[model samples]
Target: MRSAAPAPRVIAVVGPTAAGKSDLGVFLAQQLGGEVVNADSMQLYRGMDIGTAKLTLGERGGVPHHLLDIWDVTEPANVATYQQLARAEIDRLLAQGRTPVLVGGSGLYVRGAIDVLEFPGTDPEVRARLEGELEEHGPGALHARLAAADPEAARAILPGNGRRIVRALEVIEITGRPFTANLPSHESVYDTVQIGVDVGRPELDERITVRVDRMWEAGLIDEVRALEERGLREGRTASRALGYQQILDAFAGECTEGEARAETVRATKRFARRQDSWFRRDPRVHWLSGAMEDRAELPRQALALVERAVTA
Candidate 1:
């Protein structure tokens, strides 16, 4: 027999992109006899490696990572599905007395995995119709419609994010409620030690540009081409992934390759800013500098907080 109370600790490494969350997560997991449970929504898609900055097996440093590479690039992401899978993995790890190091910059995914949140039920018919409208009319049209239906949700979701726009529209159709109404205010499903890796704007911008360049150097175009054959263009969620979206646009003759690269840098910086803003809203998060000069000490500091969370 088990009590309803959850196990005492889950360490969440959250923040803007390029803030050293992944390496810090590996360090904490190694130290705590834990596995990394991915919270990044994009990393769920298979073959989205370089662009999403998904760690290579070698980079994982022998610690296991869960909830990664679990979906095909053509599959639309469902956060509710992710929540169920993540909780399963977390509970399994806890049963074995192993920590779950939840890592990534995806704010809603993090909430879905560890918060007392309820998602509005989805209807395939409504979702399919909305998605069809999105494909035909483009995100701008759907986004404008979403704005009219739920201005708050429209403000929160980017206009170019067709997949999310479709989702918002679908929820509105199915529930006849504002999309933001389903979002969590604040209740946790786990005893969490939430760490937010902070970085200065200048440094974070530079980091994002460098990372995008490295992704280009690491064969991101080739990766995209490969995935395209796997129906990546049809995959609503995966097709619109930051770098992938831009590159796919280039392939579709919407822009030049150079323009794609530049847009990727620009969009990633914007996304990072959004990620930072989202995590910053959670007062439970303990902030730590993820600057290059301070990264070496992050692991030790984060571990101390996890210990504190255990005792407190």
Candidate 2:
């Protein structure tokens, strides 16, 4: 058995989509006698299971996973709220003498949980006006405006994500500072160790394709349809989820179902690239291969890193 550290520390499993983060999180949590505090933003929404690649109850191996399926499909995701929830779970686990293992591709949510991040407050008038502009001219136009105001944030945010785009602009207007100003400079709120699962681009693309195909096979269309019946289409945040949005487009006759599937794969690949870029910028993450040959050893490697961190 590993010796206990001087104090409880938080462990984060991070990386691009389809890079085996969730499973690694489960393994680490089990090994460390920990519970998972989910950092995946989309997985917070109820009924987004299959598309978000949420682990099934059996697959979770009886390890407690906090913060999954907490939001309705119609409720917009708030990373600030998620930060609070995740920190509470992490604190609770640590108080119980168990580790807190954080897991997800959602970089901001992960950072918000472990880092000293203070999100800027919103302004109703500014938000309503920007959202009105978004509704009239679409995200593309506001993205262009954001590009002029905060080129770095614009580059980080996808142009098609109108909700985030609006939020970015709103924060800028309210604070008279760049929206990216809200982020911390890798300042940890806890004694934290970040383990990044590194999967190569080619393999990650292949994995994304296979995952999307499997999603279709596993009834993604049916899932989207059911969520639609529950107001997914009107949801500003949930409706824009990678696969869900594509399926929504197909349902609206904007594209063929097959085309939507294809687009989902392509879009997911792009998103994975962005996730990689985001995490790569953080100096704290220690990356371990999630490649096929290295897969069996990842758990050991991650544990070793944690051991080193704890023993240091």
Candidate 3:
């Protein structure tokens, strides 16, 4: 029933944390009759709700959101898998004559989903070798191995980021090419209109603090306890989230509640800075100041841009 041609358009809402990107996505979806596709990595897990700030049913307002809780904490979610699932969702949305709005702070997932990036298939043998190295030398050592083998990927991956480091090593060992070299060389998959939310540092930091406190009030700690009770530990995907990590620390008596909360806020501010840096590399993104006097105006502006993109 569908033509053998590409879809008309997709809009991606990307920005730093606490920049109201999610709110804008919801508003745009309601206004434009689009479906929200999750692009945030941590938000993909099922029980990791409060820390991820996952939208409640009321927040989504009955709009269909794809790729939000499709993966379990024990499963490994890489870019290749994400790209496949997201493309399928986008295709399905387009077939139904609806717009697809990809929204999140995870720049890597956004790029992988919309760009021509090719993530080489995972190799279990290579993964086993990397896992051995991780056991023998730890995550930092594995990162150093990646840095030596694929400096470009190393630059993007922080040393403490065991997930990425392991992935880089796994790819390099499997494909016999540097992991960074496998990225898309030219052009992207979607004819996307990129929108970035910009907020000043002080305000962003304050927002992070407030959001962390809100998560605490919303039973984020209890959620962590429940996950632990379900056997989702530190190395698991559900536990690596910023809020989850700090709350787990408190749960384990490694830190006081006050100290854990402070650390979580601080980590969140740092993560937001990293997110801004990553999205800044994309020149196509139109920056919208989060400090705008009329916060509600953002959706209208985004809608206008997307309408023009699709119509053009």
Task: Return the TM-score for each candidate structure.
Answer: 0.93, 0.97, 0.92
TM-score top scorer: 2
Model 1 is weakest, by summed lDDT over 10 consecutive residues, at 1-10
User: What clash pairs does model 3 have?
Assistant: none
By lDDT, who's the top model here?
2
lDDT of 2 by residue, 188-278 (tens): 9999999999999888899999999999999999999999999999988999899999999999999999999999999999999999999
Task: Mark the 10 consecutive residues where model 2 has the least summed lDDT.
Answer: 1-10
State model 3's lDDT: 0.82
Using lDDT, rank the candidates from best to worst: 2, 1, 3
lDDT at 238 for candidate 1?
A: 89
Model 2 spans > 4 angstroms off = 1-8
Which residue pairs come into collision in candidate 2? none
**Residue-wise C-alpha lDDT for candidate 3, range 45-113, written one tens digit per residue:** 878788898999889978889998777776666777888899999889878888798999988789888
